[model samples]
Target: MTGVTQQAKSSKDRILEAAVAMTGENLGAGLSVRAVAARAGVSTGSLRHHFPTQRALQEAVLTAIYDLVIPDDHVIHDTSLPARDRLIACLRLVLAPAAPGKPSREAWSTVYERFIAPEPTEELRATYLATAREGLRRVEYWLSVLVEEGALAAGDNTRRARFLNTVVGGLSVERAMPGEASVLEAETEVLGMAVDAVLASREPGE
Candidate 1:
């Protein structure tokens, strides 16, 4: 029984990995079960064994992507750092590339573009929104913690989370456009301005 459980878990992981890879290539389209199964080198029956419906598979994919893009490590909950600093750290992690090059940035832009599209099926929309809501929830959760720590004011954390998400969404769209080095710099500058504006909006003396 234990072995069966481990095998099932491994299969689920493979399906999710395959979905991520496929989504990277075709972000705007829904990934087919057969395609994902093929990518994972598993039979369709095997894929269905783990995810009975396309919605299930797609939700799993979004969940996996969200986990990779915004892992727990990105949310700083340290009590030592001032609330403002922690908020900045969280914003930087959400906006800036995790490395020197902008591969992660490009990848995330692709994901965001997919999210904003109208072609996705209802299942996809539900899955996408749920994943996005979870991401916002994490931001709000951290912000609330900071508020309790006397770092942020006692205001609407929900609205603040939505605002931050909008900022990231707009930045991702700008970054997704085809541009030269100068254009990249402009995009970066715009993102910096957005972050600065949000940080500046914090109330006096929290």
Candidate 2:
């Protein structure tokens, strides 16, 4: 039983890895079961045993995207660092480049591309949207840390978090678009300004 379980897990991991790799190449280019199975070097039957269907593969791929993009440590837990600094680090880590062909920029590429692709069923669209909402919540938990430590200025933390995420989302779209002329300097400057703007004011300026 243990051996079988381990093999099943290994096969599942391969499928997820293959999907993630495909996502990197063209963002939502080729993610169908047949394509994924070929990339994973597994039979369609074996792939179905793990993923069951297309939506399952997409959800798993979304999970994989977040896992790669989100920071790997609990730096927010350290009492030594100021909440503001920790919060900034958290956001930066999510957007910062991890390595060549890794998750940082790739996450946005996948999102925009996925949105453009047509889904065959409403169920898949709903599942995709749910996964996206899950992606946005990644930083909300760390923002709460800022609130608890009293480092964050008094205001609606949820709105502030969403606002920052929206900024990041827009930036991601810009970066993902073709022929956008990669401008790391300008991009980083804008992101820094956005973070600073959030921390500098509690007015929730309309």
Candidate 3:
């Protein structure tokens, strides 16, 4: 690659890395252009050149996060594993950032403070929606892979993905709250049930 192109790519990478770090720290609330530029050690003009709008920057950062956060393609693609087991493993990956007890509670508290407790600004609302959309998209992608393997019946997986996401979301909340001592076992059972529903689902005509 030419020197100038290489330099531009490096600058963009730095900006994206900074934004992802800030999002992890503050849950997308402090992702202002100035703050991201400062964290990236790039001038505001440079940041803007790479990402023209705050929404654009936020979306790009979120895409990068999906890449970083969900690298479980191995689990999804391992055909030897039971289809239900693979799906459950993929869903479990979503809960890694918020394990049970104090850490999980703290993660939920952050969500409450940023998006729920306050009347969110337009930008915050957009960010949260983008996050939810990306999550559903990710689950859909996992289901598609299983369908390709003939492990899951082929159909439009939008509804299936939503159901699985709801189950995972509820599990996350359960982890944050006081729960029975058999939390892990119960979690596994719930996930299996969710996976079974998706796997057994048939299209309306069928």
Candidate 4:
């Protein structure tokens, strides 16, 4: 039984690795059951036995990507740093890939062509949503950590995480276009404002 369990775990790992490799070429859209099975060198039945559905496969791949992209060693773990700084560093990781100038524009173009200009298929939608949810989860984890550390005021972290993500998303979109001089300064100011808003003391309500 242990041997069978180990074998199943290995198979699942191989499938996830193959799917992650394919994401490098076409984001997460390369995770089709047939395509991933071929890439992983597994039979369709075997793939189905592990993933059951394409959505499941996509979610697993996205989670794997999240683990690779944001490991436990990330800045968020550095309690030596100020909690606000650590949170900002964590948020910046999301923006790092979309560099300024041509690269950022090209990345946005790919996003548009693949998921925006055309009506996305169910699989595409699922993949995109899975990616977004993973991102949100990461941000929420950051907020939760700060709260636990007594660095951040405890309130509705879900709302705070959502607000922070929206700010990051808007900044990502802005990167795709031309910006004034001192773009870095502008971004930093905006990020600081966002961090302050979430950290501010809660007021009395009706």
What lDDT score belongs to each candidate, Candidate 1 first?
0.68, 0.68, 0.88, 0.81
Q: Write the per-residue lDDT of candidate 2 for residues 83-191, one digit (tens) a residue.
A: 6566666766665653223344576555555665566356556655756665666666766666677766667766777888887766655655453445455567776
Q: Pull out the clashing pairs in model 1.
A: none
Off by over 4 Å in 3: 1-9, 28-30, 43-45
Q: Name the better of 2 and 3 by lDDT.
A: 3
lDDT of 4 by residue, 1-206 (tens): 34544245577777888889998688836477788878887888989998998778777887788777766445888998998889888888888877877888998899887788767887678768888888888888998898889888778887888899999988888887898657667789899999988888453461
Q: Report the Cα lDDT for candidate 1.
A: 0.68
lDDT, candidate 1, 116-161, per-residue tens: 6457778567656766776787778767776776655677778878
Off by over 4 Å in 2: 1-9, 98-131, 144-160, 170-206
**Model 1 lowest lDDT segment of ten:** 95-104
Candidate 4 clash figure, as a count? 0
Report the candidate with higher lDDT, 1 versus 3. Answer: 3
TM-score of each: 0.59, 0.57, 0.88, 0.86
User: How many backbone clashes does every candidate have?
Assistant: 0, 0, 0, 0
Candidate 1: TM-score? 0.59
